[model samples]
Target chain A: MNNTATYHKAIKAATSKLTDIRKFVAKHAREHGFNEKQISDIQLAVDEACTNIIKHAYQFDQTKNFRIELEFDGDQLSITLTDHGSGFDPNRYQRPDLKKQIEKKKRGGMGIFLIKNLMDDVSYSSNNNTNVLRMSKIRS
Target chain B: MKTFKIEHRNSDGFEIIDLYGELDAHTASQLEESLKNLISDQKSNIIVNFRELDYIASAGLGVFMAYIEDVRTIGGDIKLSNMNDKVYNVFDLLGFPTLYDIFDDEKQAIKKFLSDS
Candidate 1:
């Protein structure tokens, strides 16, 4: 079985909605014997995707709206967060090499790196001024 | 998600805590407060299980770091285990691996605490 959720991206607007999404997915998955660890992983991915949209997508403008979609399969969970903001090529953004960056204690760009590492798959794309970040994890 | 429920269990000179729900800007302070109270009460050697935690931010990580020095001063330590990759990645990015004892499971974390203590 599978389930899905869609939220409009607005600063702090959809923040509370995360709980609903987590419960919705967790409840369904639990019936099929998904463990607590697997459930937490899905919730974390959703939270990260939503937070990214809130923090980066509409950096300064609150008037704009974005969309986040989460879909879950029996063994895999996927979340696609879409933002229509100043589109930057993710390809140009370099991941800060930890061993090197830690010496200076610089922050930023950690979000992307964290999201990528947590999820089994992660990809970024910009089309028609919309930045879509897709993240997925397979339940083990 | 559900609000965090803290379960404190005492096992052989160690405190095992299960932290549930999301750990973000709004909820990070709660962790700090709980830890502060525990420290004031002189209950040290804490282990946090992130088995049910959904996410964490730098500010949330700040909560853990905030108490490390204080806990260490009292000859105690704070350890974490069972972090989903997403949460683990956040900790890894913050370089927590170098500063704290992080493990893949609760057993390992508990063992590390006992063996080191």
Candidate 2:
């Protein structure tokens, strides 16, 4: 079997498309020999990232497009999501205070936090009109 | 692919919702609507069983957060039970255990609610 493979898909920035995005990542991860647990981790990280883009960046506008690119080389898998919507600096984002969230019972703001913790590497950058978020995980 | 599903049942005077498949941003609304119906009927003593929940994103987590306050205010509670480790980790990561009553089994969750009354 080839140890390296790449796949890409573009979908509208709608919440309904999150499942397809997750399946896309999971399929490539499974083909790369990632175990069930690892595949779920990768799927979840990608799902959360796309959710953030749809809800915060594109505001659930179905007309906007976000592209997901998955590349698997050997035991490592990297996913890059490119969105044409306005971008935010992920570095400037703060992890929500867990105690406060529980106290106030806030319903959101954990998407980026989960993505960072689930993936081995997560980074964000924007060039011109496109925002890119790249996340990677290694099979263990 | 199998989409998310919620099976509703009643056991020992509590509403049990069995969640199956993946629960992400798209399917969270389905859970939300079900919860709304339950709350509307004044059946807020709820236990969500995650024994078959394959995946859960933050949006799914948000659904619980969105309703807990209302449920509790109406003299009822939303309890979670039977989560696989993967699903539990997501809830634990977000400090949900502190905010919600989570149990290892549906019976225990129902017992807690029953004992509270």
Candidate 3:
């Protein structure tokens, strides 16, 4: 039998809400049997995803909200973040050139890159003005 | 407990900024402000000690990217040191090791600053 445990919350898409999001993910990840490092990785990936949604999609509009769902199916754990806003085309993403970024004093456009690096699998989709970022990792 | 905090100290002419707790989108601006204040004051020889930093997101890393060039242009540098493995991994993953100098200990970063001058 594949017993699945899930946790979900609709959090405000604001920077101040990031701490609460991390805490929420850590608790659920721990209950899902993720080790310390795995939990940390998932937490960071989720944070990056939400940060991007708040900054890029919602444009720091705290009145808007986003939903975060964490689910564990057997040894696979998946975290989904959904935002209802105008979405950007992921195909246009450029690998951040750190040197040029520093020279130009650019501060953003690194969240998606970090999310991809921290999660085992990462994907993005948008439907009907709702954008979703799904990140998954196998419990080892 | 606070999610993030910044403390500043001076050692041998190097300004040491101590990072504490989790650093994310909400907290990154505070660190940015600290950096801005230091640079505006012309105290450019900076060393960020991440020994106590429990967490960091891309927003946190972006603060460094935003300021490194300005700091260096003013004839000074920002060296990072004392990062735990997890925190270090984020920087490593982003290729920060190439453009930035990361030291195992705070003293090493300070030493580099002294040597450059």
Best by lDDT: 3
- Evaluate model 2 with DockQ and give the value: 0.64
Q: What TM-score should be assigned to candidate 3?
A: 0.96
What DockQ values do the models have? 0.15, 0.64, 0.89
Q: In model 3, how many backbone clashes occur?
A: 0
In candidate 3, stretches whose alpha carbon ends up further than 4 angstroms from where it belongs are none
**lDDT tens string, model 2, B29-101?**
9999999999999998999999999888988988888788879889999999999999999988877787689
Q: What is candidate 1's lDDT per residue for A1-140, written digit by digit as tens?
A: 33443333333424445555556556655654568777665655566565556556666344656665656665666667778776654455566554444334344555555566557898888888878887777767
lDDT of 3 at A107: 76
Q: What is the C-alpha lDDT profile of model 1 across B1-117, one tens digit per residue?
A: 467666777777778878887776456667878888889989888888899986676546757766777787898888999998878977876577987889989889878877886
Error in Å for residue B39 of model 1: 14
Better-scoring candidate (DockQ), 1 or 3: 3
CAPRI-style class, candidate 3: high
Look at candidate 1 and give me any clashing residue pairs.
A19-B1
Q: How many residue pairs clash in each candidate?
A: 1, 0, 0
Tens-digit lDDT track of model 2 for A1-140: 56888899988988888877877777778878899988888888888888889988898899888899998898888899999888887887677776566558676778888888889999999989789999999889
Question: 1 or 2: which has the higher lDDT?
Answer: 2
